[model samples]
Target chain A: MKLLLRLKFLGTDFCGWQYQPNARTVQGTLTAAAREVFGTDCRITGCSRTDSGVHANDFAATLELPFADCPIPCARIPAAFAMRLPPDVSVTAASPVADDFHPRYTVLTKEYVYQILVSPVPDPFLYGRVWHYPKKLLPDAAARMNAVAAELVGRQDFASFMAAGSKITDTVRTVSDCRVQREGDLIILTIAADGFLYNMVRIIAGTLLLAGAGKLDRVGMRRIIDAKDRAAAGATAPPEGLYLNRVTYHE
Target chain B: MKLLLRLKFLGTDFCGWQYQPNARTVQGTLTAAAREVFGTDCRITGCSRTDSGVHANDFAATLELPFADCPIPCARIPAAFAMRLPPDVSVTAASPVADDFHPRYTVLTKEYVYQILVSPVPDPFLYGRVWHYPKKLLPDAAARMNAVAAELVGRQDFASFMAAGSKITDTVRTVSDCRVQREGDLIILTIAADGFLYNMVRIIAGTLLLAGAGKLDRVGMRRIIDAKDRAAAGATAPPEGLYLNRVTYHE
Candidate 1:
């Protein structure tokens, strides 16, 4: 039977989501926990790969249980996994899925949020969760960022915003929604897309920050997209400010 | 010269606010950082004493510098202290203060907030920031808790809620406001008082938790206050869920 699990993690102590030799990764830790609960031969697959120090409010994964008569109940799976996982990682929910359902292959939109702190006073509580940019943005910068973000919607090639050093040739993807807003001391940038390229969200965040700072404008964003060159865009923002918010499945 | 600083700390790694021999305390760390910027002979006084693992959003402190010609400028004091302090502790603001000013004695009101997570699923991000109570509270429990908390307002001898082992004989204090509100998955208990006894807020939070669970009520709260015995109230809640929200003084 296939099991679907919803997970949340701080990601500060993790190398990334994928399993890597001689490194501490979220997948490696979850796999170890899964092995302890579902035996050593269990199969585990993560829906999305995140960079180091990137947090996730909601992440999905799939696990294949070999035993049909597993003693662990569906609702009790989270509790059982919680015992084996570290305090920084938590399995929030678990349920049985169809045999053909894949965590990644299910066509749906994925949401990501990037948080930036704009206060001169540093917050010790949000140390690793937000990018502390002490500089003040131009007045009405949030609206300008939102205006620029709206240009990315619809199916288009986003090669200029993609990070370099990727072997995949296709850079075309459908962006559903993009929003920029301010909440208290935080500037939140949320983007939803059918798919994302390597470091695409981070690059977009970096570019929006530039626009908010008045260094770039909406016309500049259009030019960058037309150029289709990675060098034409702003630098990639740090992973600590990024959070994988949600992943919706069609079925 | 005297200087005042607005401080913030996570308090997760500290023993408490007071300085102790061979122990990691917020006072000890702050003093060490103070000495680094204001010479070794400087004296530091904290506004309030917080228990171990209790966070602070806005704590005030007064520092007496022995040298009038200190190299660090007044505006640069926070930055200098920031360099010497850990990431978990920060000096948000620094300014000159009158020689007669005192952080504790000159205070008007102190506000504290206790957070309780009312969810079956645990939150990894708020693990150390809130009390995780998986049990469902009785309906209208927040209003009941508030009704009970209202009894704490006004001047009264709160010996029953105070923890034992303090040498101070006086237990009379004035509570200006006590509120209980729910925000999404968190039930926040905010209290503002002229003074607080040792472990007073924690005990109140504990008694309110009982009230929310239908084990106690407003009548029980009045009786607890009237008894004036240390053992009359509920158990002291854990320190991790408490936060010293603000310290306001009449200038």
Candidate 2:
């Protein structure tokens, strides 16, 4: 049997989802709990491998396993898993999935949100979870920065936006939708992408934010993207502001 | 000049607001930071002292200083002080206040909120910030609790609803307002009073929650309060759910 789980986490305390040799990873924790609950070990696949300090409201993962007796309750799994998992990582929702349903390959859309905590005095409660920028940026200015990011929508070569790593040979991806809006003191950057590269979402956020702060122009960002060189991009944004808000796998 | 500031804090990481002999209290942190900013020793009087693992969204405090200074930017005082403060504490606003004013005495009201995370599964990110209850309580229970707590409004003998060591010899207290409202997945128990004794509010919350869960009837709670015995009250709720949500100071 295969299982799919919807999860949320304040990723600051974990070293990302995928299993590592010795580090405490979200995948490792989840896999261990799953093995305990299911009474068997299985292969668990995640939709995205988020960086440390990055948050997620809806992260989807699938695990293929064989259990002894019966189906575990969806709500019960998160409770049981949470008891064994650390404080920062949690299995929020879980359910049995079809054998053919992949957590990533069959995803319909992926939504990511980046938060900008624009305030003179930093929010102490939000210190580790939000990116605090003391300088005030006009709402229109932020919209303009997001406009630069909007230009990169649709299928395009994202070589310039990719971080300094040749981990993936494919650098092309499509941004289905992108928008930047302000909710109170929070500048919310929501981007829906058919696919994303290594640090692609964060880099795009950084580039547009520079334009928003009047440090870079829209034309400059376009030129950098056209340059197709990793050096041509702006600095990568901090992982704290990034959130893998949702992962939509087709029904 | 005397400085009055509004602060917000997630108190889970610190001892209570007052400075303890060896523990890290919020007041100790503030005093340390104030010394660095004002370049002299100072006293900070918080309108309310929250316990460990408690949280505060609105609070007022006085930073006593002879800031008739020759140099540093006064407008940036809070930001500067914030840098030295811990991640859980924040100065939301700072302004010069009358030298004679006292935060505790001037406070008109204080509102404490208890957030019960009513769900089978606990939220990892909200650990230590919310109290999770595995059983799902019936809706409208909050309304019933609110109605029951209304009987305790005005001045009344709150001895039975207070902790064992409530030192304020007079057990009479006025509850301006008492509300139990369910917001999202949380059950918010808010109580406003002129003041409270140590653990008094927590004891009240625990008793009220018992009424909300149908464990205690209104008549039984009234009898308990009239009995004037601390043991008649329900157990003190965990500190995690309680928050010093607001403090109102007089002009």
Candidate 3:
């Protein structure tokens, strides 16, 4: 039976979602646990290819078992996999799905959040969980960031926001929402899109950081987007601050 | 010059706040960093002795340097210490204080928050940060817990809440406030007290957990407190779920 699995992981120690021969990866770890739980080599596929040090609050994946009648119930799959999985990765939920369902090509939006700790001193509790910006942010930083972020909404060619050296030609993607807000010392950038280019969210976050620091304005951001060149955009923010917050699927 | 330092730490990898001869400890690590930064054996005293695997969001300490003519300014002390301290512990703020100021005895109240993840599956992002309660919590668990917690307010004999092997005789303490609230999948218990007995908060949290589960009620909680016996209370909750959230000192 094909099963849809919802999971979350702290990506600090992982190389990424894709499996590598030597380095540790979330896909590799989950796949091994699935094998141990099912007593067979089941094919495990993830919904997104997250970068190293990126986190996920709600990630989606699919598992295809060789046999239809497995001993463990769909509800018990998470518990079965938990016994063999590491503490850094977990299967939160599991449900049976149609054989034609694809984890990656499914219709819906993906939401990502970037966390920035705007403080002079680092916080141990948030050491690897957020990007620590030592400089004092402007009092109206969130407002300025939101102004720049609003320009990112809707379908557009996001080539400028994509990571440099990307080979993919199609950079047009539909951004449903983009917002910036501050909660105490942390500035959060939340964005949702139908599809994302490589490093798109991180680059946008970096650009927003610049906007918050009074380096760029909404017009400047629009100009960068129109430039359609990777070099025109801001630097790609670090992966540690990024979290795949949500994934929605069409019924 | 004497200094008061406010700090935070992820206590998972440490023995605790106190200095240990061989084991890794927050005090020992901070002292070593102080020696490197100040070029002297500065005495460091913490406000509380946290247990292993516990965490602190706001902790207080007093530093007494043997010599008062040190070069580093008070504002830059945190920055200087940051260079030498490990990533797991951080000195967030440092300020000049009276020579006899005590971090512990002079405190007015300390606030702690205990977190419980009410879910069937363990969350990887919250590993070692919260107590993963696998059973289903009642829909009104927070309200039930709060009802029991409200009985803990005011000065009272809290011997039942203290650790079993504690030798401290004076178990009477003033609890300024106690509350329970739920945020999404996490149930949080926030307690503020003038002083806390060893494992007092953990035991209270455990008792509230029972109350939330319908195993105990407000009357049961009061009976346990009135009994003034450690055996009468619920088991002590794990240290990982308890965080030293705020430390307030008398002006």
Query: Largest DockQ belongs to which candidate?
Result: 3
Cα TM-score of candidate 3: 0.95
lDDT of 3: 0.92
**Per-candidate local distance difference test:** 0.88, 0.81, 0.92
**Candidate 3 chain A lDDT trough over 10 residues, lowest sum:** A68-77
In Å, residue A133's CA in model 1 sits off its true spot by 1.6
Candidate 2: chain B TM-score against the reference chain B: 0.92
Candidate 2, B6-86: lDDT as tens digits: 888888888888899899888898888878877788778888777888888887898776656424565777688677877
Give the CA lDDT, 0 to 100, for residue A85 in model 2: 69
* TM-score of candidate 2 versus the correct structure, residues matched by position: 0.93
Query: Where does candidate 2 clash, by residue pair?
Result: none
| lDDT of model 2 at position B69 | 41
Q: Rank by TM-score, descending?
A: 3, 1, 2
Residue pair clashes in candidate 1: none
> Which tens-of-lDDT digit does each residue in A1-251 have in candidate 3?
89999989999999999999999999999989988898889898899999999999999999999987666888888888778988898898898889999988994999999999998778888888999888887999999999999999999999999888989899999999999999999999999999899999999999899999899998999999999998898888899999999998887
What candidate 3 gets wrong by more than 4 Å, as runs, is A69-71, B67-70
